[model samples]
Target: MIPQLIFLIIAIAAIALFTINIRKIIRNINLGRPEDRSDRPAERFMVMLKVAFGQTKMTKRPVAAVLHFFVYVGFIIINLEVLEIIIDGLFGTHRIFASPLGGLYNVLIGSFEILAALVLIGVIAFYARRNFLRLKRFTGVEMTKWPLSDANNILIIETLLMIAFLTMNAADYRLQQLGAQHYITAGSFPVSSLIAPLLPNSESALILIERAAWWFHIIGILAFLNYLPYSKHFHIIMAFPNTYYSNLEPKGEFSNMASVTNEVKAMLDPTFTPEPVAEGGKFGAKDVTDLSWKNLMEAYTCTECGRCTSVCPANITGKLLSPRKIMMDTRDRMEEIGRNIDKHGKDFKDERSLLNDYITQEEIWACTTCNACTEACPINIDPLAIIVELRRYSVMEDAQAPSSLNNMFGNTENNGAPWKYSPSDRFNWAND
Candidate 1:
């Protein structure tokens, strides 16, 4: 009774903490301006099913994809064992499902053991790729110290958790073979049976090992759950929603702000009446809040995979821009703003904007308005949209642009083209 009560308390506490952190993240995501992505419900659902659930984009790298698919499937399917553990822990029962399901339980356990072993292999391969083999995409500038350490930490945690699960099974199987009380001779252990012989056969020692492994696996899962909010692994939860809310418009089409579009329409149509502009109104995104809520959500959903940067034309040509860096910077700035809001009030104003503080003008302008970053992102994160907004702010609000851009803007205004010539002279070049 006491053991059941203790386990229940700990489980409830972990759940409460996880729920609170999830709420805080949602609150931060809501801090951005409103966006309507409510259109095309059926299409969005299919996209989510394909991209997030199916992992279609991840298959672009077949070798890594196969390993990742095993790890992902194992992580999800192995949780059935966790369900059994939870039930056993709550009721102080031993292998509760084994007696009821009989042969099926044995098959399930056998399959879980095989998957757990495969998960271990996959995680080891991932660790080797990141640390030893040093995959260029995983070792880029944005993947410096903390990001690298975080990736390694997750892989290590996964490896340890799988080991704990198998070790617990091995210990339990050994105890069952010894005809120990409450140790049912039920579920089959294909992989753990191989491990069981290596373990000491002492009854007391086996009990200790089983209990310790059980505790380690459950406690590690709880710790990992809370850690997701802080780590890039949070995408495991956010990816579905992010993919569903992805921009489905033409890749080359830029979304002009509603206010800016109305202003432009007013000028074009003399009969159109524009809303009165408030003095000192800002244009484009000057801070995190100026961006749409979907833009902010993209930051939370970023896996930091560097696929966007790997295929980026600017990065390929040795320019100062990295789309991965742009996403990371946006996320960092959003986090800073969230922290400030927590300390102050919801309407708290920060002196630092995302433009000069987090991302530089050089990086923004280096982009050729190409959608390569969008195309390469497995989760459909649009880093170019953020870049375009920042660029608009620099040109319109700050009135600060490169000399070449200024000349081009002047030519467009006067000659209706990007060349410094009269409209009649456009035909003169053809005549020459």
Candidate 2:
């Protein structure tokens, strides 16, 4: 009766979590806009296969990558053992792994325990690098706005999982003492018959303890599942799609400009003038809606790991451009715009919006169009593109370019290059 009740509870909870979370995931996916490039059906399949299974980006940091991969595989395999434990606590039988493949099950469980330990140690190293060593070369001066809640939560989750494994091992040892068949595989999992001396002689107490541990483990998992979308763990789900759909083109290609109809007609009628596809046309993003859906996803998928900022040449060179902050700012602006649009209609405009007002013209131009940020990003965010778009807006529409840029533009119009030397200077270099 206890087993049946536990089974029903777990089934119901699992169903509820999947239903709620899956709906939210689908909604976020649907919000994505169409890409301007030609769609290739095969490209979608290739991307899905590569990112979901290949784990290509993780290879950037080999030690962390390998450790993470082990943890990921262990987490998945250990879930089967969790189900068996759940069943054993409720009923008299651990049917799932008790048959011919029992040896395989023991081996997997032992390996998982070892991998879990390694992951915990790896996470500790990561914390040390971020906090103590300060790893300024990889991470900037540590910015502690919220006291590392995500890291702490991950640690707590791992600790609880490790405890669950120990408890399961203890329960198994007790069962072996009570005349249950012991199967040894690879000698990795050392069965301690010593547990029999510690546990009560009565089977009832053993059953009760097993049931308690089972409840604790299952509940922990359910809670983790629900919390995933809200926490940094959301990257676990978003990372694949983000990488798969990442921009493959050069960072310099800011969207294609709309074609100008007639240069003469556009010049004659200033109001009716078609903005220069290269100049006056909508080059950079004017508002949140102006951003492509892929860009929007990039914002949401940021893990705030500071990996991009660490690799940024501009940040290294003492410029104010932090790639991580740029992504965050864009995300904040998009959410802010979304909230305002919701309160007012789509047509409603705020002329005095802080999104536009706070971000300066100079900061946008400081970017050197370096692809380092994009290359370093585990989720394939392109901060370089955002900078370029903003520069396009400043140059073409407002005519508010930097002095250097103004001089360049003037030279380009006059003699092609920004230099004051005559056009004949190009052939003069050839003679030399």
Candidate 3:
């Protein structure tokens, strides 16, 4: 009865957490963000499938990718074993996995255990690279906020999972030694075989140990479930929708702004107005709210894996713009605005003041509009688009442009290109 109660409580809590978080995630996704339409339907689907299932990002580092792939597959398949364990605990049955397909179940369980061992080895290597090797390119100028804490948490979770695996096997072996049904403990689990000789030949002790292992295993799973949303594991849930709604077009597409008359009318109107659609009103994002929902989603889905920053040409050449940090800033700003809107109303203005006070104009202008950041992003986050939009707003609307940009614009407007040479020069060399 106590075990049933414990199961019920944990199950209820897990369902509640999953429901609430999923609702928030879905609502955010449905916000109708703009996306580029340049990609063919088939191409877009292929890219999504490749990134989501093939794990293209993980493969960037070959060894780490292989290790992670096994662990991911094991974790996904182990849910079935978890369910079986729970059912057996509640029903006092040891023959649940002894049906016609019992052999298949055993095979899966065995495979998961082997993969789990490999994952542990991989995580150990990751820890060494982060802590001891301390690669300058990975760490960046600003230290990661939770470097030590993140490492500790990852280690602890892996260690506890390994212990749970061992304990389950050990208790099963002891049960077999006490003459429990052969179906319950048939052919030895590798880890359990090592411990069989150490247990006393006492049936009562076997039962107690089995019950204790059940409790420990369930508790560890529940703890992990509860902690998932608040940790880096948050990506596990975010990755699905992030991949589903990712931009499917050419990376250079920016949302065209509405015409001036429509924008001015909306600004002057007292009643709330929809976004303008007139031609040439403005050509890019002026503020955070001006960004499409897809862009906003990009901000939230970022794993802060530093993959974008590591490949950024600017960062490699000692520039101030780290594409990873830019995405982080956008997310942080959106969250702040969300809080303010929640406190006030949708009509709540003064968003520009908040953004200007936080993000600097210099930082905004330093961007070279190079697409390196977008090319490097595993999740297809286009930081270059966001930067370009900001530049358009600063120059056209605010009448503020850096000296270099101003000179380039002048050349383009007057001569159609930034080059000083004349187009007629091409014919000079073609004379017969």
N/CA/C clash count, model 1: 0
Q: Model 3 segments beyond 4 Å from truth?
A: 28-43, 89-95, 141-143, 180-183, 186-188, 195-213, 252-283, 341-359, 419-432
lDDT of 1 by residue, 1-432 (tens): 997898899899999999988888888788777788999999999999999899899888898888988898898899988998999999999889988898999899999999999999999999999878988888666777888888989999999999999999999999998999989798889999999998997999999999999989998898899889889998888889999998999999998676787789988998999877531357778787778789899999998988899899999888989999888888888889888878997888878988899888888989998898999888899999999888888998998789899999999998999988798777776676
What lDDT does each candidate get?
0.89, 0.63, 0.65
Tens-digit lDDT track of model 2 for 1-432: 766786767768876987776665444433334455346647755765666556677688797678667666666666776677666655645545656565775676666666656655666666666668866643443344532666557657866765666565566556555654431222134432323366566656765665566667777777777776555566667777776776766665655544434555667777675554433335455554445667767777877777788777778878777887777676556555555655885556676421256456656777777688887876678877667766666776668888887988888878978876677686886676
Q: Per-prediction TM-score, please?
A: 0.96, 0.76, 0.80
Relative to the true structure, candidate 2 reaches a TM of 0.76
Worst 10 residues of 1 by lDDT: 275-284
lDDT of each residue in 294-375, candidate 3, tens digit only: 6777777776667778887777778776777767676666665655656787567753531355445676676766676777
Instruction: Judge candidate 1 at residue 176 and give its lDDT.
Output: 91
Which candidate ranks first by TM-score, i.e. highest?
1
Clashing residue pairs in candidate 1 are none
TM-score winner, 2 or 3: 3
Candidate of highest lDDT: 1
Residue 401 lDDT in candidate 3 = 80
